[model samples]
Target: MENRPQPFHITLVRHGESVGNAEARWQGQADYPLTDTGRAQARALAERWKNENAKFDLLISSPLIRTKETSEIIAATLNVTVEFDPLWLERDNGDFSGLTAHEVRQNFTHPQFSTPYDPVGGDGEGDWELFLRAGQALQSLLKREPARYLIVSHGGLLNQFMHAVIGVAPQANNSGTRFRFGNTAFAQLMYYPHQHRWAIDRINDHAHWKDTD
Candidate 1:
């Protein structure tokens, strides 16, 4: 009998544009439905995954409505079911919730504001803490299943996870894959169990929407 090779393919996808996202407001822990364009983006992602023909053993998403919806769309195309988890939700921005990026920078610039390494506003979970939790969660999921998986989450959350898994900080611009994932864009990562490391395979792969523009 031949031993099967370890399955370690993981795809991370940011949810489509929500109302707060389109409005340029902070959407941390805010539940918003996908906009019309967001729905289209979800469909586009589904079609792209279908064309790729890669089989995913599991589909996981943040409990947030936007991510859940997006994951559902992709899962439908893949003919799979999705598992929802709150741990995958975006960081809680605390008082900065529902504020625009400019607003967050201009008025809320506490010493700990933008630095994930510090306590978030001395109230919410620090960015580093979220990163650690995400890493742990991903590891646990993979250990339990050890198969190809898809994770649909928010941009901020996904970015943090990417930084954690790739050993890159936010300021390390050119050192790692900087993913500006548009609505429904997908990124791939491979987890090598031997090295216990996750490697970025692709970033912001939006081939499905290329011809639409």
Candidate 2:
């Protein structure tokens, strides 16, 4: 058997926590600024990349303020410009936009009205559909760039992207092969063009946050 060629190399980073995160509210499509702790987390991640001599050929992020802020922090240390991409935006929660988790569960009784558990409602794209589009957009972008890159996005989008790359569903406590992205965390992915698949190199790596409180 011949060795298969690897796909493009990419890194996934989740945006730092935001006010909505602290308040346990669904911020889908709602813009929220990063909290003080979130800023610290972003700084810690940036420092980690600098200390480890990490290099990125390109830096991309969701257009959302939180993701843009987080990407800027990392890009500063890398001395690279950041690109804001709408495709990288987080899931659109639609009607669930500003509702708390409890409120969503209480008000929406549909089978798919749960958090990280069920699909969201309203005029939003289905989770599966969003994943498909995001994966396609990423693949197209990788083909154009074809370089080591860093992407700062939301947790929901990250999870879906991981699933698209690894050909699996995103679940809690999955094994190392599974794709899991934490707040201000990162994962390494290599695309295998021969197999037309994206292999997971690492997931939910938070070594950058070691010194953070």
Candidate 3:
């Protein structure tokens, strides 16, 4: 008998715009509600998923209000139940939670203010640390053995997860892939059990936005 590889598909969706997004504020560890435009973006995401005939056995989201709200909208469209998980939560920004980029630069003298991929000072999370967490959380979730899954979270968290999965170096100078994750940006990946590897099918895809426009 030959050993066959088990294949699983994973989709990551960044939550839509939040009040912080509009204000250009850093929304770390803050539970902010989604904007009206954000809700419409989530609906559009669902429509795109439906149009593509996408199906998933599992739906997971961060405990943040914006993510939960976005997940709720998506889950309703896909008829899937959402399992809120703190492991997918955004990195803790500590005192910088509600500060704008300009304010953060003015307040923090740390190099992180200039190069965010380095590490934030105070009680905030380090880029490398968050990368490890994303790796661990993803490993744990895969243990459930779902064939297909959807995850809703913040852009930074999703980027960390991708870095972990792809074994990308967590360095400020890495300047890795040139992909921008706009609001409601979605990515598709596939895991191969035989190779113990994951492949990116899509990244930062936002065709849904164009469709709605």
Candidate 4:
């Protein structure tokens, strides 16, 4: 019998709530520690995985404080060490970093018309740039041997990664599709490198803490 190519099992997770999240800040690349609720969410996720007997061969995370804290909690529960990568970092929001919605409106003037190529926050990454970065991150992951990978990252990057997986280009002026990744929410995916095929098993999974804040 011919040997079948091993499929890569990837779980993309958004970090739990942070101080910035509580403050409703943009938080793009701005380091903010997880809030108390955020830590509770992480624990809940860890408990859920432990109960499910979930196993991951590799654990990767963004170095941001929020993501690092969330990943550390899960890693402790799963007995996996986390490898941090800047590529997994959140999209740089430039001038908008650590700003709230009202503050952003007060500070930056909104362009009447903008394209995906237009820089965000007057200097931050454009949609296409983030998409390209996501593609690069995906490619790097594929270079490793097929295994179960748990990635703790930000919502913006994860959304771009999903777009890359589905071959969707960035839309102009934020009119593109969006994936909602709540605190401690995750997306499970499978990739067959030999056949260049991908499967999305789940998206925005946070059943463990649906009842709680």
**Which of the numbered candidates is closest to the native, going by highest TM-score?**
4
Give the per-residue lDDT digits (tens) of candidate 3, residues 1-213. 996866888989989888888888889878889999999999999988898888989899999999999999999998998999999999888778889999988987755233434556477887777887888778877787748889998887888788778777576643555346788988899988878877898988888885421
Per-residue error for 38 in candidate 2, Å, reads 0.8
With a 3 Å backbone cut-off (N, CA, C), the pairs that clash in candidate 3 are none
Q: Please identify model 1 stretches exceeding 4 Å from their true place.
A: 1-4, 102-109, 112-115, 169-178, 195-197, 211-213
Q: What ranges in model 2 sit over 4 Å off?
A: 1-7, 112-119, 169-178, 194-197, 210-213
Lowest-lDDT window of 10 residues in candidate 2? 169-178
Can you give the lDDT of residue 52 in candidate 1? 74
Q: How well is each residue in 102-150 modelled by candidate 4, as lDDT tens digits?
A: 9999988998888889888889998999999999999999999999999
Model 4, position 190, has a per-residue lDDT of 98
TM-score against native, each model: 0.84, 0.84, 0.90, 0.98
Model 4 residue 45 lDDT score: 99
The Cα local distance difference test for each model comes to 0.77, 0.77, 0.83, 0.94
Backbone clash count, each prediction separately: 0, 2, 0, 0
Estimate candidate 1's alpha-carbon lDDT, on a 0 to 1 scale: 0.77
Those runs of model 4 whose alpha carbons end farther than 4 Å from true positions after fitting are 211-213
Candidate 1 vs candidate 3: the TM-score winner is: 3
lDDT per residue for candidate 1 within 1-213, as digits (tens), equals: 977558588888888878888888878887888888888888987887688787888888999888988888888888977999887889887777778888888886555225545655446657667777777766667667567888898877788787777676544112335557777888898887766866778888877776321
Model 4 Cα shift for residue 58 (angstroms): 0.9
